[model samples]
Target chain A: MDSYASTRLTRIRTAMKDQGLGGLLVCANGMRRDHVRYVTNLNVLGSWAIAVLGPERGPALFIEDPWDLDRARRDSWAESVTAGPGLLDGIVRAAGELGLRGPVGVAGMELMEAGLVLALRERLAPLTLQPATRLLVELRLLKDEGELRAIRRASELADAGYEVFLGTARAGLPEYELVAEIEGFLRDAGAEDNMMILASGGVEVTGMRPPTSKRLQVGDLVTAELTPQVNGYYAQICRTLVIGEPSAAQQQSFEIFWQAQEAAMESARPGVTISQVAEAQNEVFRKAGFGEYVSKRYTRARGHGLGLHFDDEPLIWEGNDLRLQAGMVLIAHPNTYLPLAGYMVLGDPLVITDGGCERLTKTERRLFAVAP
Target chain B: MKRGLVEWDRQELPEGAFAARLAACRAGMCEERLDALLVYTDVWRAGHVRFLSHYLPYWSSGLLVLPLEGEPLLLSTQPQRVFPWIAETSLLREVRAAPALGKAAAAVLAERGWRRAGVVELQELPWGIYADLTAEAPGACELVDASALMRGVRLSEDGHEEALLTKAAAMAAAPLAALDPVGQRDWAVIATLERAYRRAGAEDLMLLVTSPTAGQWPGVPREAVLADGVLLQASLEYKGHWLQLSRTWLPAGASPLRGLYDRLGRAYAELSETARPGLSEAEAAGLLKRLAPGDGLHLFAAHASGSAPFTPLPGLDGIEEGMVVALHLGAEDRQGHRALVGDTFLARREGLARVTT
Candidate 1:
């Protein structure tokens, strides 16, 4: 195993021991893979996968799709890998073989299929099953050097995707077609996956959604959150642009978002609560007499942690008490509705440092304008 | 994950089709004595809900509540601000932003006084959602598995669905047909294909590459020089329908595996020819065994395909008309040389018609 995998395994094993778990069954799917990836370093592609890790023996990876067996064996750090017609059955058999008769923790249990969980409980018998989703989340709360490298690369790709978006957004272009251009560029540039959502309109647009057939018109505020994943790590960059020259109202509305994002990022330091960071952003809107827009009625999170999953821990929102720690990676975006000019987004991916935070996204924090 | 084009084509999938689908689902619910049927959708398994509502979530999850005799409602994790877009893109008029999908669904059931509720793919429902739902209602509601009912409803494709599948198959085959893997890097080839798929408006895709001789399993593209005897398997979704196609690339020369490739092609042809509406699973397996009778053959041969979460051919009784299936045939020779070929086919009364050529 590489140093990165070795370090991760060591940490996971230590956590398992501390939790009084005899074994760990890490589950993942295409949608939620951080748990399994953190345990086995495998990028799952099938419907679902499970990594059976014991105290004495190494981890054994099991995937549902037989076609994915070879890939899982090749990519995963686990010594024993099996592809199955029945993923849960394979997990049960592996657990028995590993002699795990005590309480076994199953990460991502909440996200797992209910029937499978029930079957596992019945089959495992005396071996109790425990929910370990929080355990995995706490382990992945901080970014290590290897993870930082991947996140930095993903941030770079997000920047490149934004450039592609800026170059492709034009009047008369369909929203889907514009997304296609950005996706193509990102894939060609070595991004395996991206979570992108865009919206193009004037004040009528409330927020970004999956690309639609609506055509971009002049003076439309095209907003997008371009998050690209590289090496199983994700970084995001949210920005808004105008198809034509920005209007005075659009510019004025965008400045507030920029300021809010800046304040949030500045407040993102070690020992600061995520709610404080979110309050900093909301305070900007409050000073501008748009405080209501910061609530859930008009917007979601001010920002969120970006990692293997698009929305990770320390989600920057009011009332979230998770503290910012050094080595934690997150994005602080003041993306919300502006009465003067639709929803505007201006955010950057940054990593919390000992003193403050370091910005990973190099995109200029401003309202970009594409020539009509 | 599906960052590519994701727009509802009103002309391709009209409102009438969604209405028909909802009506069919309600008909099934009525027959099953179900007050309401719930279809959960996420990025990975959105076929059931998308089929009935044309609402494929970009992220998070959603629930489609189909009452026996009322307008269907959609509860999504997306905020209410994006409901207008959801309404515009889908046939759903009542779209509620439910952060907790199961809780919201449970509340909806309670509000409607629904007692007998059926959940499609009940086994696959997330444990958290299931707990929330069952906990919220306790013994007041009864949830039953409706996977078979849903499957029966989706087994036969409509004309519009077939057209979408045909288009998706063609799109999947386009890049493979144009690929020149000779002297090209593996990642470059994959990147080129991905670009093509996205440019053609694919919503999502899964591509794997393999070299049979190197004892390597089919895997995501890595940085390696591509040579002769490489296999590429691609499954791409257009709009909401999925189609799979596999091809083995070989340099033109006196290759040792030419005979194997030819034999595999013949087996695929024969399998396609023999697969009809009434073909039984045993008969299909027997035909495959006779065509490529050996211990080196891969166990997985065929599966029903048309939407996300393609069902394997084991639990299903047999092939039927209008059913789209993807057949894969692969075997290894005594010298360790291996060849695999596959194509998506549409089962008809006469015979199977190849959808991906």
Candidate 2:
């Protein structure tokens, strides 16, 4: 109906044609759900779902929950929304109605249960089911105007969460209470969901989880990765705070990561490979005599793509040579464990532009020293 | 020299509680003639894993392998970077940082020389991983669906689980006592509940807020100025057990729900009285339908709640003693005013006792 929806369908159809797919069974679970949301514009509340799309005919969305059927019809661009108390039957019905005969593409199959796929194979005999995960990921690689708007809003909410973190990280406050305060601020600011991990201690901290009853002590280093989702688009911001005056070793440990993150951002220009950006940060660590700590032993990832899902394609890590393209949003952080300061976190969301990139979050990046 | 949330600690199951669960699981494995049991869980469905192993995985996928005899192993996709946090929260001894699930599971089975293995809820496992396992360890081990075996052991709440459920219900109910509807928004109300629940040791929460204008349906928290009468409902999961809570904020004037709440409260009381060891699920459903006759009742009037959400729905067989159940009741007047009440009840041979108030 709308031009944007038409454009999206056309782009997907082109991909389907290129892949020799007459129909595409786009599956989404709680883990890999951006594809269905991208095509249907409906953020599925259920755990798993599928969208049956034909190159010529309109798409049919199959949802697990009956209550969600009404919401899907209202919010989704798909012309048909069917309730699938059992998803396999819904898929069969959609395929029959759409008359999709020939090779069918299945996306997000990794998240799909093995039994479901086997059932589909048995039920839809003679129809070839091919992997279409890459097609969907490529389509979502670049952000459109509407997606950018949602990502901007999500990033702003994450910034608001950081502000709350700054104000609440004080001595004697339990970690979970501070987590509650930040989460409360985000929810009140219209964040639909959030995944925040935080840990606070004096150099003995390992990582963060949902706020616990552990109270903060003076001179504690509080590190948190605050990822808030608004309208299904997630923007992540990782920041660290000191409960009181920071020690010399603590400040120095934070500076290493701050400089590394800056180096990564400098190489995040369009047309530059993601590995180049990672190399820039890894070089910083190596120069500082912390080269050995840059691997997975010390950090999970140097950074990763940010969008509807927390980690998208073109993950910014060593050996990943995917080139950076304009409109691709990323949360680049060189958060690693330091010998003296433990695990310190400092990262922000930014979007690749035609030239360089623009930071989406406005929270200050320097080590925040909260008053006791 | 000191800075931390020292008092803040994860709500852990007592060591004896874990030992009991392991004993029960091993007994089930023995009865089923299985050498090992593999339980897979993601964020959505994790009660099975959390019930046996004290590991509450939030972000990624995890597998808990319990052999017929030996220490259980936690196969975590998270890197060694999070091993410390995992160790702090879980009771599993050997936590293997496994990126590839199928390979890791196959290796464990091969190492233990397990010939027969049971997979809990085969329908829930990813096909890719199953294919990989079949390819990797063909004939090395035989896998069977043991979901029924797990359900038999975890359908009822143990003493420790019951205690956690009681605590979760109280935490979910605290924010409703003083919710000011005059100027609060829907998200603000939800925020209040989230904060209170987390502070009171809630691990997971599914909250919904609605009003006369918004209609009575669960949804994400949005900015809507609360009207005189607003309904706040939640299904809180605390330390792996669940309970339901619903409260209404009435304006100063006379409200239609004033009578409805009393009627629903009576229905809950009546259901608690009639619910016993021998009462069938259909019989309980009949009693709830007859007592709390209304237009706004969900699909199930009463169902099992511990470990899994609504395991045995209405029309099922008899309810067993020691089973934790969530009783949901609601009513709507002709003028569109609605009153909803839900709570967790433990069915015992002596009688039914409400755990969540």
Predicted structure with the largest TM-score when compared to the true one: 1
Please give, for residues B1-357, the per-residue lDDT of candidate 2 as tens digits. 011111213354577777888888888889889999999866666678877876766677778889887788888887876677667777776889888887788888888888999988877787666776667764768889998888777864587777677667677667767668545788888888777777666676777776744444446656788765676667777666767756666666786567776776777667667767677667866875788565544432344433334443332135566667665555666665666666667877766688877
Whole-model lDDT values for every prediction: 0.81, 0.76
Query: Chain B vs. true chain B: TM-score for each candidate?
Result: 0.92, 0.85
- TM value for model 1: 0.94
TM-score of each: 0.94, 0.92
Worst 10-residue lDDT window for candidate 2 chain B reads: B1-10
- Each prediction's DockQ? 0.59, 0.42
Error of 1 at A192 (Å): 1.3
Task: Using lDDT, give the best candidate's number.
Answer: 1
lDDT of 2 by residue, A1-372 (tens): 677778888999899999889889888775667889888888776567789998787689987655366467877898788864466787887787887777988888777878888899888878878788899888888888877898999999998889888887888887877777877788788888887888888666655555667789898888898888987899999998888898999999998999999998888898999888888988988999999888877777889998878777768898988888999999889987778788899999989999999999999889999999
Model 1 ranges off by over 4 Å: B138-140, B210-214, B276-282, B293-295, B299-307, B314-322, B333-338
Q: What is the lDDT of residue A313 in candidate 2?
A: 73
The prediction achieving the highest DockQ against the true structure is 1
